[model samples]
Target: VTITDDSEDDCQYEEVAADDEFSIQEGDEDLPKALQTIQEHAEDAQILASQSVLLSEKSVSEVPEAVDDFLCNFLVRLGMSRTLDCFQTEWYELIQRGVLSAKDTGLVPSVYTRNQELEMENMHLKKDLENYKLAANKAKEALLKMQKERDFHRMHHKRVVQEKSRLICDIKRLKTHYASYEPVLKHLTEKYQTTLRQKMLTNLERDRAVGQITGLQAALQNLESG
Candidate 1:
């Protein structure tokens, strides 16, 4: 009974492990989702930058140093700082504009910060996704291994059952043969006893006949003498 329970529990445990693996797979799927979100935002930023080229040129002069630093950092982080030649060239002119307010300059820095934050988040999520996928694969492999082992056990179980049945059938046949021969064996014993009794009786009769013949011969001799 304990063995039966253990076997059932092992099967259940394997199933649970497989389910855990699937859960990890689902978790990994979210990793790509976060990356996709970041990519979409990056694309949006690229589109905004392309459409607002003049805005970049105009803000370069009037934008605060903090905003300027933000743009520089953003470009550096994105590996595009060296390619900002036109933005750099127009910086002097925009500084001389003296028309746009500081508030108007804040937008670019905010966008850059937001992009950086999104990128970092996406990278973190990607790492998590990789871990999840690894776990899922490991669990799936274990499940497959368990299934193979279970199948082997099942086959062995079937063989054992078949062997047990065969043994039981053999035992029954032997028992039947033994039972069928019991009466015959008994009859043989009885016949042997009867034959021994008949032999003893015949020997006794022969001895008596010999003794009577001897006595008669002796009497005949006595008469001749007289």
Candidate 2:
């Protein structure tokens, strides 16, 4: 029994060695690719870590400007000497009395300053709105005046057109009235010419008749003498 067990154990050890050799050969082919991937990841981590530190330093440098310093700067910039003096007196008094602490005296948040800016902008916009309204009212009045003038001119033009129409009608009527008299004037001229010719013929016939009567009387006188 001991000899058979020893032989089985020897066969198992040889099979384990063969499996280990196969695994090593397969992993050796991909070792360089795995190392390159790990190297790229390490470089990316270093860049990210450096950028994070820069951003952290910048943010910290911007956050804690101390509320009192901000107020002093604001008052000085606005030229408020009396108000700044009063504020400093009160603020230092409170600080010496231990009524304020570092925790209570943080920087003024961006939200508050942004709100003040919005309020000032709103006031300016309201002023501009009022000015625009006044300008609009004046423009509306001017437009109304122009419209009134246009209406008056339109009415005047209509009256002038009516007057022209009436004048044209009167001219046409005068022409028709003159046309009625033209035929009567022509007939009167013909009658006057006929009367003048008859008068001339009657005068000639009377002269000839007078000459004949006188000759007959002379002829009778001659007969009596013979």
lDDT of 1 by residue, 138-178 (tens): 99999999999999999999999999999999999999999
lDDT tens digits, residues 89-196, model 2? 999999999999966665667676566558768889999999999999999999999999999999999999999999999999999999999999999999888888
Residue 79 accuracy (lDDT) in model 2: 90
lDDT of each: 0.71, 0.76
The numbered model that scores best in lDDT is 2
The CA lDDT at 219 in model 2 is 95
Highest TM-score scorer: 1
With candidate 1 superimposed using the best TM-score fit, by how many Å does residue 172's alpha carbon deviate from the native? 0.3
Give the TM-scores of the predictions, in the order they appear: 0.54, 0.50
Segments of candidate 1 deviating more than 4 angstroms: 1-108, 224-226
Q: Cα deviation in Å at residue 176, candidate 2? A: 1.2
lDDT of 2 at 199: 86
